[model samples]
Structures are given as C-alpha cells and as structure tokens.
Target: MTDHTTTPPFDAADHLPDELIERIRARAARHDAENTFPHDDLDDLRSAGYLGILVPQDRGGAGLGVAEAAILQQRLAGASPATALAVNMHLVWTGVAKVLRDRGIDDLAFVQEGAAAGEVFAFGISEAGNDLVLFGSDTDAAPLPDGGYAFTGTKIFTSLSPAWTHLGLHGLDTSSPDGPRLVYAFVPRSAESEGTIEVRDDWDTLGMRATQSRTTVLSGAVAPADRVVRFVPPGPNPDPLVFGIFSVFEVLLASVYTGIARRALDVAVATAGARTSKKTGKTYAQDPDIRWHIADMALAYDALPPQIASLAADVDALADHGARWFSLLAGLKHRATATAKRVVDDAMLVAGGSSYFTRSELSRLYRDVLAGAFHPSDPESAHATLASAWLGPIES
Candidate 1:
C-alpha cells in the first residue's frame, strides 16, 4: 500500500481520481453488455495524459517508470479490465521506448514523442500459429525501393484497432542480402495506409468485450524508412527491442490480472458481510469456512503485486538478468494469471449461486480472467521456458 500520491514524478490520484475511476467503472458493464469499445473511457484517459505515463518528463509525459506504470495499470484494471487491457498496448510502446532510451539505444524515441502527443500505438505482432513470438514472424516484409518495408500479412488480436494512430508490427524479410531477418516497424494510420490496412469488426468474445481486439489484414502496408525500428536475425537473440517488448508487455499484463483478482476479493468480502447463512443464523463473514475461503483468496492475491513491483523495479533499474529474464518474466505472468483465476473462482463460491447470474460482477470477472491464459505467455510456453531455465534445454 505505498501511497502513490506522495511517490514523486506524478500522482496517480491526480491522474486517475476517485470520481474518474467510478465513472469508468460505471460504464464498464454497459460496454460489456453492448459488446462495444470504451470510446468514452479512452477519451477521458487521453484527457488525463494517461497514455504518456511512461514517456520522459522532458518529453511532456508523467515520466513514470515501469514500476509506477504497473501500479496505475492495476488501479485502472480494477475499474475496467477491458479499458485497461486495450490501453496496455499503447503503454507497451511507450514502455519499450523508455527502456531503449535508458539503455542508450534511442531506436524508439519517436514512440515516446508520439505517445506524449496523444497518439495511440497498437501492438501488431500476433499472427495465426506464430508460436515463435518475438523471435520470428509469419508476416512478409518486402524491401521497398526507398528502404521502407511493405508488410503483407494478417495480424490477429490487434488491440486498439479502432483508434490507433500507429501500428507497431514485425515481419520476416526473406529477400534481404543479409539473409532472413525480422523487421520491426510502425505504420501510421493515415491516408497512405488507406487501402493497405483492413480492420475486421469481429471482436465479439466471452469477455473483455470493450477491448475490441480485432483481426488486422495488411496488404503491403508500408512503414517508411524513418519508422523502421529494428532489423534482427530471426530466432532467439539478445536485442533491446525484443527484450523491451517482452518485459514491458509481461509486467503490465500481470498487473492487469492482479487488479482483477483484487476486485474479486473486495466483492467477495462485501457479499459475505451482507449475506446471512440460514443454516446457522449468522452472516457468511462470521462462518469459519467462509473466513478460510477469504484468507486463501487474500493469500493468493497478496503475492502477485509485490512480485510485479519488484520485477518492474529491476527493469527500471536496468538490472541484467541475462538469459534468466525470460523465465522470470514468464513465470511472473503465469503465476499472476493462475493465481487470479483461483482467487476469482474462490470468490464466486463465496458469493454463492447469485454470482452465477449473467450480469453478476463475479460472472463477468470470471470470463475476463479466462483471457489471461490465452495471452502471449500461455501456460505451456511458460512451463517450457521455466523448464529450460531450471533443467536446461533437452539434449538435441
């Protein structure tokens, strides 16, 4: 419970006041029910300068580090998971830019400037069956005559699809003289990209509906030479761009789910205090069994935030974990998502059958929490990464 208001740089309370949070939370249900994106929420957040939290102060941003960003993200997620999740993509780019600038590599400085100017950046790395993640891409990156790259492929789960001003994506450049390479670039959503990008209105899902993370089809969408950020050999390698994306993405994602768990716990506590057990003529809060359930939920939920904070602090400090970074980050994400699921499940049970109703908060939380498993570091990928780190890769 660090008082973020007194922490320095910027105040979370000032940026996201209680009234603003309540307004965002108030609209979450309507957006979820209507399966629409939170345009109003986004407008409010933009006005608050939230989209630039990671940009440096000199760059007209809050100048917060990953640690503080994690805290603010948790607060936002507690109010509206969909809004927080959608905004995470924008934060990812700013965080990545911060990481690079801190490390003396200013490849993504434009990202910081763009964010500070209220330009939304969407992550466009995900492709169908592209298990290689950041190490590789299925999208085709053709070299243009002007040193730009024309990316032709489909990217799934493109968050902030409707309003993103710039789309950050990676693709495989097979014709490069240096052999196959992965080109990381950003395509601005402008008249130049009118016929090149197609956003499908196919974001209906089980939960987190306000995210509107839809499919993006890119047919020769161009990233001007100035916007092309990195050119690295495909396969696992030590590149700042890769590490920046992975680290910021994982920590922020863990923060979002951790927030969901916190909300579920709070709801359970309120429900338990209000609901009386007819069998014992006492409230569920007074029941030993119910107390234990809450204790378990708290125990599981309590461990996540500290873990995220510590790792995020290390990232901000540029502590080198070397090859261990991947395992540590993946493990953190895995634990957060898994623990959140358990906490939400326990909460539903504590809140009783009424929580099973379609419109119940717990019911929506249950569905929102499931999307955690399907994020970048799936349970399988996380376990494999951990196994490789602890047990070493299997003998080829």
Candidate 2:
C-alpha cells in the first residue's frame, strides 16, 4: 500500500487515494484465482472518479492529461496488473476522446460526457491476423438508410466485456460512396443492447486472468447514425482517430508493463535483502553479483517512467512530432515491454527457486509481462517503424 497518498510517483493529490489502491490489490489475487473480473475494483474506481480521469473537467472529471494518467496507471499496475490492464481499455477510449476534443474536434464529446456520467468504454480494435492494426479492419460496417451502420465481425481480446457500457470500434466500409472507407463508431452494450455486443465466456489464460478480456462476437451490432464518428479512406489516413487511439493505447499499455517492472524490481530487492547466503554467512544483498543484478534492474526500470512522462506530456501539449510521434510512441511501448520482460527475468533469477513456483507473485508477474509484447505496435512493427524513422520508409 506504500501510502500512495503521500508518496505518489506524481502529485496526484487526493485523486488516487491510498486506501482505494490497497483494496484493489487485496482483491487482485482472489479475482485471479476465481478467473473473474474485478467488478469491485471497477466499482471503487468508478466511484472515486477514476474511470473519468481523462474525461473533460468541464464534464465533471479530473481532466488530467496522458502524463498524469500514465503515473496513475503505473502506480495501479504495481499493485494489480490485471486490474490496471483491464481498466487500460477504458482509459484508452476516454484518452482518445480527450485527445480529439483538445484538437477542436467535438465528435467524441459523447465519449467524454458518457465517461463522466459513468459509462464504461472498451476498446474493440484488435482482430485476428490483422497486423495492419489501425490501418485496416476485418469488421464490416454496412451502411444504413438512416446513416447508421451495422457492424458484423468478431472483436478479440475485448477487455471489460462483462461491464462496458460502450464499445469503441472501427470497420471497413467497402461499398461507401467514397469507396473503401474505414468507419469508426461506438456500440452500446446494455441489457436491451445484448445482441449488438455479445460477450463470449472464453477468457481463460496464463497471466492477467482477472482482466477477463473475452472474445466479443458482434453479430450485426449497430452504431447509430449519431454514434458514427469517422469515415476516412483506408490505409494509413493520418486521421485523429488513428493518432489518438495509437498514442493513448501504446503509451498507457507501456505504462502498465513498466509498473510491472517496478514491482518486480522491488520484490527482487526485498528478497535479496532478506535471503541470507549459506555460502558466505551473509545476506544475498551483500553479494556483489546480487547487488549488480539489482542495480541492473534499477537501471533498466528507471529509464521508462521519464520516457512515458515526457512523451505523454508531448501528447498533452499536442506537440507536432510529425511522422516521428508514431515511431517514438511505438518505440516507447516496445522498450517498456522489453524492459519489463528483462527486469522480471532478472528478478526471477535473483529470487532463485522460490519464484519458479506457480503461486509466487514473481511467477504471476512473469506471465503478465509476457502479454506486453503481444499488444499493438508489436516488436516487429516497432522495429520497422523505428527503421523507417532512422533511415526511410522501405523504398516506396
């Protein structure tokens, strides 16, 4: 519980109270054990106005930017990665809305207002074999007479499936007047809106089990005419939707994994200090090699928070990084995930056989960190992006 109110990574004030985080941490293992969503955590967060951290202050939220949100998420993830990961989807959408609104685009105003009013949003962008990421989609957005759309496709790894009030998604509209438009919109998931957003019970996995990010099947889900937000031509149309989602998603995602690294390092340090070596009749912490490992873990973990904060602040300032923002953000994500994996591995080794057990916290962290590599802007994509930035886009 670290008295987060006083010792927060950022001066979060009274927003991220210490008690709320402790309660969230207490339930994480149980939720992981039961293979269930941390509804109570969500409830506490919702009540504490966490779900609306990115919603506009004018709209009854804290009205913070991505930098502060990154700090909050890192703190939360250090306590409970699954809860932080599950909530990341919601923050991504709200952050997207904030990014758009800051750019003088009022289209996603509904998202901000909805979030402030307690509407939960889940990101529904990832599709199987769709490495094109935001640049493409397998979902079909069939146009309607009333200007709405009927989206028919499966959205995988949709976190907060069991409780999301709105699902933000995009689909390819090939038959549009503009021809091959990538339509983006939000689909509701009320009881009356069941068929529109079906939550499939198929989220059994290794780490981050409590996220319950089930496979969502959209059997002709409808996003009303008003809900229809963008209709840009496909294949990297540099739209706000693209930039907003990409920046927020990758940044927040990176923040979560970085926090995992922080926790892992802390655990390793504690274990090292406590475990006395039988060989030298001294503590492992006193061993030069062990101290070196801890030093390496700190060295690796320290670089990420500043990077996240700096880039996130750039996002808040709406800094024009031109084509560089993509590579920078993607690189930050890639680095964070990679660093997290490396730190966790070092920590596991430093902890010795105790960490090998399935029930160990380090073991849980090992599995959770594995997922960081699988998120958007993956390793290969990030390298390609970075290469293009350093050299040039692959010869047309």
Candidate 3:
C-alpha cells in the first residue's frame, strides 16, 4: 500500500485521473481493515494537490470552485467513501476561505495560504448533544489579552485529527465584558505551546473506518490573535461563514454519497451481468426482476449529480437564494445520503452472498452511507428547515 516510487503530478482535472483514483482505491481497504487513517491516501492526494483545490491559482493552487470539487469528490467516493469523507473536512476550510475572499473578506486568507502551503485544516464544529448544529456551540472561547481566543471543549468527529495543522472551530465567549460572542477561529498545531488538542483513538465504528475521525479534546487550545477570524452574536444570524460552511460542506458531502450511489448502481449492473440464474440458465442481467431493480436504483440515483453540480455552481457564482439557500443546500445533502443508502441496499441484494461479506465494498458502503444520515442538517433538522422555508417559522 505504500508504493511511493513515482506517480502522477498534482494537475487534477474536473474529474481526477482514473489511475490515481485506483491507486488511492487500492489503499482504502487496507486502511479500513486496520481502522487506521489513510496516510498513504492522504499523501497521494497531497502530491496531486487535492488539498489545495480551493486555493486561488494566484496562490499556487488549483483555484477551483465547489462545483468542480463536487465532481472530483464523486469520482473519489466511487473508489473510497472514507477517503472522500476525510478529505471533505479539509475542503470545508479552503472552500470557506474561498467564499470569504470572493466576498472581499480576507480574514481567512491565512487558511487558503496554509492549504496551498500543504497544511491540512480540519472542521472542528461538532460537539456532543449540540444539536443546534452551527447555530450554537458548547465550546468556550475565552478572550485573551493579546486579542486571541482560547478554546476549551470536546469536539467530536474531528476528521483528519492526526494530520490536520489547523482546526476551524467556533466557540461561545460568554465571559466577555460586553456580551456573549461566538468566535470563529483557526487554531493551529503550534498552539501546543499554550495548550493541546488531544485526539482520542476512538473512531471504531460500523464503517468509513479509514477516515479515523476521532474525538478531540481541546485543553485550552489557543487560537492566536491573528488566527481569530469572526466575532459574532450567537444563534442563527446571517453570516457568510455560516453560508459558506453549510453550502460547501453539504454540497461536497452530497457529492460523496452520490458517488456512492453511482458505484453501487454500477456494481449492481456488473453483478447482474456476471451472475447466472440457477432457475432459467440465464444471467441475472437477463432477468426482468434484476433489470427492474437496477433500473430502480438508477432512477433514484440519477437526479442527485445534476442537483449537486448545479447548486455547487450556484454557490461558486454567489447566487442569492436568500433564506432559501439553507433549505436547498441541506436538502441536497439529505436526499443524496438517503438515496445512497437505498441504492446500496439494493445493490447488496443484487450481489447476494458476496456483498454480505463484511469485507465487500458494498457492505462497507452500506455502513458508511449510514453516517451521512448523522451529519449536520440531518433528516429532522432538514425537514424543519424546509418547512420553515415554505411555511414560515413555526407558530411561536
């Protein structure tokens, strides 16, 4: 899995090169088998400049938008969902930086520069029982005299924990002289001098094992004055950081699961073609039932890629959906993940006993796809968001 003699350079297209994807794909199962982070996968992607895909070309990076990133993610996820998911955490930061810079908010320029300079950034917003999602945080952001902030909270599901150089996080600073301020900041590993980020080796789960998105314990992890980016009132106000994170994260996440659906559909088709029916002496592909199941899978899977692509492009172009954007973006993530689960189930049935094996890719996908349902803007929250969009806020 560590074949690093030579490989492709970092000039990825709209879709990643198939050979490189296959190389990353080859390492996926081993990483998952060991419940380890895909270090080789990360190294290969880094060599291909994938981590800097959102950095501006002027900054010695790809300068691509979320739309292009979504396409590439779909391709990557077809091979490895865990890899895609881990990479998604990094992309969120660069994508946010791009959104900020595009709107003339240079506060996150350091994040972009860091990405281009080969620094891995992790999304550190998740907290236990914090269902308010991005609207609030349990993390404490204590303001420092030098203008920086110190974060003390347990952030769960910190993807790329072992490798990330910066963690983009938000915390509530209630002890401020004025009022509670939700500070959004990037805490670098250098903060080990002042504090430490303790990453627990506790990511054992049903699937996506290769992600190694372990729990993080921030013991006064400090975001220096220069790294402190946003200071805002908490609880669901209008902010570009909010929009950028939701838009980029949901869109890219949807792309990953959409690719899962695509791969499942393709695998089902392949299985149908190769497996012969014991009853009719014909291939499963010839059976009307199998064809219909495959068709149903395709039907469910078809609408997502176009939806992901269009909405991602809209985000890049800065299209104004106003209050509707959250619903639209979150809705895409909800639908894609849900659809991928259904498609994977169907494909597993199509593959029969082989797919039932725990090591089978479809089996892994079945478990990995379930995680999407657990991400932000989950089904219940997504429905609430949509209902609020269509019918106005709840009666209160």
Clash number for each model: 0, 0, 0
Worst 10 residues of 1 by lDDT: 1-10
Error of 3 at 112 (Å): 1.0
Off by over 4 Å in 2: 1-10
lDDT of 1 by residue, 235-257 (tens): 98889999999999999999999
TM-score of each: 0.97, 0.96, 0.95
What lDDT score goes with residue 396 in model 2? Answer: 50
What's the C-alpha lDDT at position 182 in model 2?
89
What's the true lDDT of residue 210 in model 2? 88
* Candidate 1 wrongly placed segments (more than 4 Å): 1-10
lDDT of each: 0.92, 0.89, 0.86
User: Per-residue lDDT for 1-396 in model 3, tens only?
Assistant: 111212223334433677888888788778877889888888888888888989999987898888878878888998899999999999988999898888888888888888888899999999999998788899999889999888999999999978988899999999978888889998888744488888898999888888888899888899999999888788887798888888899999998898888888888898899999899999999998888999999889878878887898899898888888989988999999999999999999889999988778788878889898999889999999899988999786
Question: What overall lDDT, based on C-alpha atoms, would model 2 receive against the true structure?
Answer: 0.89
Q: What is the TM-score (0 to 1) of candidate 1?
A: 0.97
lDDT of 2 by residue, 1-396 (tens): 232322334465366788887788778778887899999999998999998999878998888889889988988998899999999999999999899989999898899898998889999998999998798999998988899898999989999988898999999998966678888999887666524666889999988998899998898898988999998777865788899999999899999999899989989999998999999999999999999999999899888888998899899999999988899999999999999999999999999999998778898899999999899889999999999899988885
